[model samples]
Target: MPIPPVILAGIARMGMTPAALIWGGDTHQELLCGYIAAILMAFSSIASYLPQMKETGKLGFAAVFITAAGNIIISGQQYGIWAYGAYAKEGLFVDITGMLVGIGMMLGTILLAFVTFRAKVFPLWNVLLFVVMLVSFGVPGLESWFALFWGLAYGAMGFTIVSGKYRNKEAAAANSLNLAS
Candidate 1:
């Protein structure tokens, strides 16, 4: 049997809590938590994509894949920084790469949000909250508070998914059809 979408989405959304802990301090433990958060975010992207796939198609898949890839890169960078102080201080190339990847991931996330909104697999309120959090990333003073906003947005989404507030009838029908064949 396939795992429920709620479980996947819920776990992915709640996983951001650890990532939020990065703001607690720059300790090695915090960095490791951030690394784990990246991995969870990667899986979350994949989880978020599943329900929307039938409606969003290849564009959605591309966005999810890019987001997942970006998360993986971020995870690796976090690990490198945590493991080697010299690497963090001297590796200009890694820093540049991480910045570029982060920007790419942000763009991919915007695209995914748009696609997901259009597909209507998730609730409008949750999507709007997510978009607002993303937009907050660009606001001068609000940038520092992004992690908190992100945690709230994803946490809301996770709760909604777990509570069965959002349903994808098309995906369900498709799954039933596939199972019968």
Candidate 2:
């Protein structure tokens, strides 16, 4: 409903569409564009996270690699170029790369949940809510529903996360109690 949620949904929908298109054998320039968009989204997310290291930690190489894999899949499909080299009929390497990226994304999400939980930085309920959204993005055969749910869930969760951080800051200023710096 709000801007952040809309962005979150867009990211999930973008991610889901490429996989669906490839699985349906509908590789096209559109897929390539979506892949690029996904990477841009990842980068933007990473950049925005720079100042909020405590709230959203730094993006790791694995995150970059996973996002790159999505870009490669779409680019390969659109232009017939494989990152590893000439495409073989078997496509073993490409498939493996994609699956690995997917796994990385899943694990990264779990890590997010763990970090937020351990820090007690956000409401427990909201943390659970975000996890549900993250999971929906990867659930198979429910692309549209997943996108919708994730978009709304993460959008709300993101706002809550940021708001909680702000509240912590305010609380610290008021109490003169140094938070975990």
Candidate 3:
């Protein structure tokens, strides 16, 4: 989560949308990294939902699902494959699909962050980082490097989850599970 451009640089997540690749330079490494980063991004976005649901209830649940939907769309697209490989020029459908998925993913991520903020489960800084990462559209010439911050934001959250740093809800979750058992 902290990041990897091709691996640890946050896997080259240029724009999380095929539209970004339209300007070209979608090489094998770039495509591979982008896809991988996108997958991680989706998972990272969804991870915040669990803790929030306890505090915000259905509102949090909705955000989680929406974010997941968007992530799934971004992950499932053939944008990377289409942009760099043999089928690069085959059809317009693929690009259009990627673009649409990007839109959904953007909305999902934004909503999820909002609910998580309301829930107050994660650290304030981490939440802010995630929000910033989600909304930071790159400037005209600096798009390639934008993934660094995104990676940092997600990476930090990943670390937080792993360390159980601010996981107040998880303790309750464990007790609830034990009671059920």
Highest TM-score against the true fold, candidate: 1
- The 0-to-1 C-alpha lDDT of every candidate, in the order given, reads 0.67, 0.47, 0.58
TM-score of each: 0.76, 0.52, 0.68
Please report the TM-score between candidate 2 and the true structure.
0.52
Model 3, C-alpha of 7: deviation from truth (Å): 12
Better of 2 and 3 by lDDT: 3
- Given candidate 2, what's the lDDT at residue 104? 64
lDDT of 1 by residue, 37-151 (tens): 6776777766566656677788889888898898788888877878885557466788798788978888887888888788887778878877887988899976445655655
TM-score of 1: 0.76
**Residue pairs with backbone overlap in model 2:** none
Better of 1 and 2 by lDDT: 1
Which one wins on lDDT?
Answer: 1
Full-model lDDT, candidate 3: 0.58
> Comparing 1 and 3 by TM-score, which wins?
1
